[model samples]
Target: MNLYFPASSDKKTVFSAIEKYISDQQFIIVNKDENRPWGGFYVIDEAQAGFFIETWFKNVYDPLPRLQEMVSPKILVVAPGKRLSWQYHHRRSERWKVIGGYAGVVQSFTDDETEIKNYHEGDVIRLQKGERHRLVGLDAWGIIAEIWEHTDSNNPSNEDDIIRLQDDFGR
Candidate 1:
């Protein structure tokens, strides 16, 4: 569960270490821990780098819109009083249409900067790439239609995409 990265480690270096540690589909065994949302980290084995290219592609470009597609859309049903992780994506931007119920949208730039906004049905909010954001269901269950598109990028496959600064589900 623990690996050391040098202070000067770059993104590729850190990613390589993670790749080496978690490659196999069933490489590790974990025991159930009801108290921890993630169960808990148990054991790790060195695994063959069988799917690096595929993993890298998914990590970076899987969400890119297909040719002739206008936008990739998804519907999220958030339970009452629940919230998404505080996270940011490097490769995509999103627009959230509050289709039902109330939504509390929280966003931030720096650690010291934050804004919380409330939206009701038919309201919309835009999130730019790399902007930390979270959506909370208020009072009742909430429904959102999330429309997103890939950001302009030269490589578009650098492998570091959704960076969760904080996660309620411990993921």
Candidate 2:
């Protein structure tokens, strides 16, 4: 979720640079077409790999006063060998599609947590409010996250609420 002033809106050149940058690093390119064209790679640290693909993509679009926000929902790429933590979002819920990799998801229930399940490429997953969920990529695949904002903003999260009963990352 990176945005630039596009002093010239030369999408071709700028996007090319983004692709090169991402490939130069290890970030996998999830989507690169007309609908939601993205041109940058976001690398997640240990904590972030155990969290959302990018924990701070909101500001990239929010801070741009000149932009009209062509879209509300954003798509994020979670490269292979990465994982998100057991957490929930107050502002948004996400729908994930494993477009090019294996997705391992774990959900928490009232008394016990569901065993981590795997999804093949093209499988879809929906995350609702208060549904503590975590994910990780396997092999050389990645996940695309479509974010949808909730109607209410009062639902916030705290560190205490994140009860990571088990984590392969050792969190």
Candidate 3:
């Protein structure tokens, strides 16, 4: 079961409700197969800073009380003319939804070839494991909701997950 809190909802009220529901063990995340087209549902909790979803894998029978700390589901705001590094992940996959402004996503499987796509608000971009991708803000500031998940559950670490082929920020 999935619960969504609107952007206008009160933070204190939502947080208290989530805390109460969790303590009562009423909130649980059910996992379905990846073949289902979309990912499994999550018990999402929102705050002013951002939001995080608690999701479980279909192979795992027991649900974790919370998601991994390194797994961050947050809003990314990229300033105009700025771009993230051209990088790939070894153990993680990310789905990005453009919420505001415009974005240009350059992604590819190999370092030699890349494809760029323009995205407007409400557009979604999915990056699978080992896919090199980069996000660029265009025209104005771009805001995107990034749902980051670990592909390898057994080894969930960001120590070497990111392989940056090119970076403008110099690391």
Which candidate ranks first by lDDT, i.e. highest?
A: 3
Clashing pairs in 3: none
RMSD per model, one decimal: 14.8, 13.0, 11.5
Which consecutive 10 residues in model 3 have the weakest lDDT in total?
Answer: 32-41
lDDT of 2 by residue, 1-171 (tens): 232212333445544554564455454544455222222223222222212334323333343221121112333444345565566655545556554435677776442557878886556676776677877654433435443434344542332435554455576
lDDT of each: 0.53, 0.47, 0.57
lDDT of 3 by residue, 1-171 (tens): 112334343434434443444435443323212121111112233331122332222222144323433455444555556677899998888777765566789989898537668898767787888998988866555556566667767887463778989888778
| TM-score against native, each model | 0.55, 0.46, 0.59
Relative to the unseen true structure, what is the Cα RMSD of model 2?
13.0
Q: Which residue pairs in candidate 2 have backbone atoms (N, alpha carbon, C) closer than 3 angstroms, thus clashing?
A: 49-83, 50-84, 50-85
Off by over 4 Å in 2: 1-72, 79-81, 153-171
Identify the superior model by TM-score, candidate 1 or candidate 2: 1
- The CA-based lDDT of model 1 is what? 0.53
lDDT of 1 at 65: 42
Candidates sorted by TM-score, best first = 3, 1, 2
- Please report, as a residue range, the 10-residue window in candidate 2 with the lowest summed lDDT: 64-73
Model 3 stretches with alpha carbons more than 4 Å out:
1-71
- Cα deviation at 27, candidate 2, in Å, is 17
